[model samples]
Target: MRKHLAFAGFATALLMLAPPAVASADKPEPRVSGSMSGTLPKEFGPWAGEPVKFTIDAHGRPAGVKGTFKVFHDRIDGSKPVGDFEGKITCLAVAGEVAVATGVITKGYVNILDKPTEDVTGKKVSFTVHDNGRDDRIFWIWEFMGAPVNDCQGTAPAFKPARGDFTIRG
Candidate 1:
């Protein structure tokens, strides 16, 4: 009888030590998508486009980025979308010199900085999204005339960058 009792106790202890299983629903999906209307700075001459509309699509999970993104830049002539492309955001996070959050974006890593002048509700932040494979398609938000402009990327001078007014929904 004592041996049987010991065995039962061991069994109960084992069960209690076991880790609880979590359902798939418990995990939240990782996705960042939004749009913004901002300026596209002209790197060289004194030419900056007015605030324009641009969209973003980033989807993935915690610590893992397996999503895509699309960018559309309007021409100064009010003609076609001179800047545009659909690519994958292999990594996603908000981390860098500022230390906001770290994640991989469309092609490379990005450093996101929140704007103090604007409230967090408007999602005012800075972005420096670059590509790991190439440094040509990098985008960043920097202080332009006191305010931050969200368009600039290239070899000589980075052009057009919209503001970071995208809201996190998902």
Candidate 2:
């Protein structure tokens, strides 16, 4: 029958040029933690007991930093806490560093007056620290006054910390 209809038209043109099979869908990776407090700029008194804990991965940059600062005796009568710090944080961002922090005060500051002793360390001092993710809101910049200010600022929810931390990582 004409070579079996040309072999069924070449097997229906090789099943219409074959090629059709796909199944793929998987994408989800981005996590961040939170928790922060501010107020601790008496010129860092002198390491104010050794306060400087940081950790930002996910891409933020900074990866890890320990803690410990001390330097009392500068109470102009503000009461206390002239220099109190804390620590704790994790990282995971690569290439230069993106942003990823866990928790624990990033930067601190306290000196409104009414009893604000007077530890302007060196000068430049601002507060408003706290950022969990998506742009929490941070803005601390304790420069000169004590030297070694860590800056921070966000938008979503809140993440602010820029007044003194010395930021340093690799």
lDDT score at residue 17, model 1, on the 0-100 scale: 98
- The sequence of per-residue lDDT tens digits that candidate 1 reaches over residues 116-170 is 3321222222333332122212343323224543312112213333344343423
- Per-residue lDDT tens digits for candidate 2, residues 1-170, read 99999999999998899877543224223333333333335554442333332233222334333222222222444455444433333332211212323233334444432545443433332333233233334333334244453333222223233433222223
What TM value does model 1 have? 0.38
Off by over 4 Å in 1: 1-29, 41-47, 94-165
> Relative to the true structure, how large is the alpha-carbon lDDT of every model?
0.40, 0.35
Deviation in angstroms for 133 in model 2? 27
Once superposed on the true structure, which residue ranges of model 2 sit more than 4 Å away at CA? 1-78, 91-101, 105-167
